[model samples]
Target: MERNFLRRLITAPVAVALVLGLAACGGSASDPGTPGANALSGSDQESTDKYTTEKVIPLEEVDPAQLDLITEGTLRVGTLSDAPPNIFIDETGKFTGFDNELLRAIGKKLDLEVEFASTDFSSLLAQVQNKQFDVGSSSISTTDSRRENIGFTNGYDFGYMAVVTKTDAEIKGFDDIGDGKRIGVVQGTVQDDYATNTLGIEPVRFYDYNTVYSNVRNGQIDAWVAPSQQAEGQVKKGDETVIAESVINTQNFTAYAVNSGNKELLDALNSGLDAVVEDGTWNELVKEWYPEREVPKDWAPGSQAVKLP
Candidate 1:
């Protein structure tokens, strides 16, 4: 009788476990539901709560890289070498820009060696997604779409775009900006999307921002619609022909986007970002590069790819 009673208890527990196991198998949170970053297809994850940002989350407990710190010194960072004052190269063949300096500051806090791998801004998303680098330092924009794949740090540079041209240019607003104007865009970027869709203009695309700038400055094209920060660099560095007008596309936000799965790296990046913002590092970078305008929030490539604010 005692044995039978114990067996009944065991059978009941086993039945419950089997039921719960089946439920878990059916509803596991990690299940890839749809396309786009382990999401459920045909399901609108727009309501997914994962996008809700925790501004000051700590990276120590969360980031996986710390757990596997094989190198102990290097934190490979990805950046766009074209966005001046944010991430760009100097005439001396040195990487000297806004994001360049800020990311170095982050490296100091983490006690890690920093290496910059420069590529097209569009690749920032894909490379970070693939773990090509530890963090993305290019001034990336944050949006619902980008959050789907890569995590984002708090905003760094926030500004608008400018209508730059050789003539005392007549490209006043978004509408006329593309009207009969041969617009230029960096290849494989949200800028290309904006040029093709919103601006209603066919973009004279280049492989990188420098080419876009080169083509615009040499008067090979009428104007170049680039980030205000990039345009600011050109203006400060003496691009006489290009003029930045207060067009809508010119004024947008940007941020440093990182791949999402690496919670440790994301946390560290955000923590470093918080430190930077607190010690006035963020604002100082703003003042150093853009002393002329008010810096807003942030922008990311592939971030919703919405019209520039």
Candidate 2:
């Protein structure tokens, strides 16, 4: 028997398929049909009341010019192991990636300790609303629907979604996917809605974000709709291929979300993000995680901020 000593990730949501023993955050408790109540209604959320993530960090490494607040301890972050580049256990059994590095710098700057709480991707927003953690550093995109449930900071990074499949699959779009076609996605995600409604396709929802890619690679699932950045990582790890590039919906912004009503926290996040970008730490992290892609010359924190009509 292989000895498995994987620890659960605390910052993001896990897929339903990722076994509890192997999952970073356990699975979400949300009912797909019922959106979670305001954070006040959840029990585990009590940790967030005085919940703070504080640490001392070297801005020079991530951003030297930013206003630094040296806090007392680690910031408890929630996550689901549903996506990579943002969160994942590399083959080396270490939790390291885009979200991890960026959050580390943020914690260092704020002087907060960093702890990750792993859960199901489907349960992330509800957990955030419930105050399950201080922040969600996952690469979550901002959708008006989600904004209605929780507040999102300005986009820290952006990437579109795509459909990955076998090189030989005959899929053009939703019409090509069928009941017999086992599509993979994290339950309660935008990809879930897209596959179920937009594309008019039904998918096999997995527990761990990795299982989708795993099933697809093994020919157990026909395709997977995933974020572009993470898709590449899964492909490289599992030897999969991208069959199509899905475009972003017109109204969404890639962003980090916080519990609603936390204006002070939101302000801090925006301020920290601006400082990161101005001092070039944002660009550096982008280069480190996604060397193949490029940030728009005009892209900056809050540059994408828009007033709802």
Q: Least lDDT summed over 10 consecutive residues: which range in candidate 2?
A: 17-26
Model 1: lDDT of residue 238: 56
- Which prediction has the highest lDDT against the true structure? 2
**Model 2 lDDT per residue over 15-90, tens place:** 2210011111111112322222111111221111111122212234433223221222545677655467778766
lDDT string for model 1 (6-91, tens) is: 11110111100000011000011122221111111122211222332445554344443472332457777777766777788778
The C-alpha local distance difference test score for the whole of candidate 1 amounts to 0.53
Candidate 2 has an lDDT of: 0.55
Q: Write down the worst ten-residue block by lDDT for model 1.
A: 17-26
Q: What stretches of model 1 exceed 4 Å from their correct place?
A: 1-55, 58-71, 236-238, 247-253, 294-309
Off by over 4 Å in 2: 1-73, 91-94, 172-175, 178-180, 237-240, 303-309
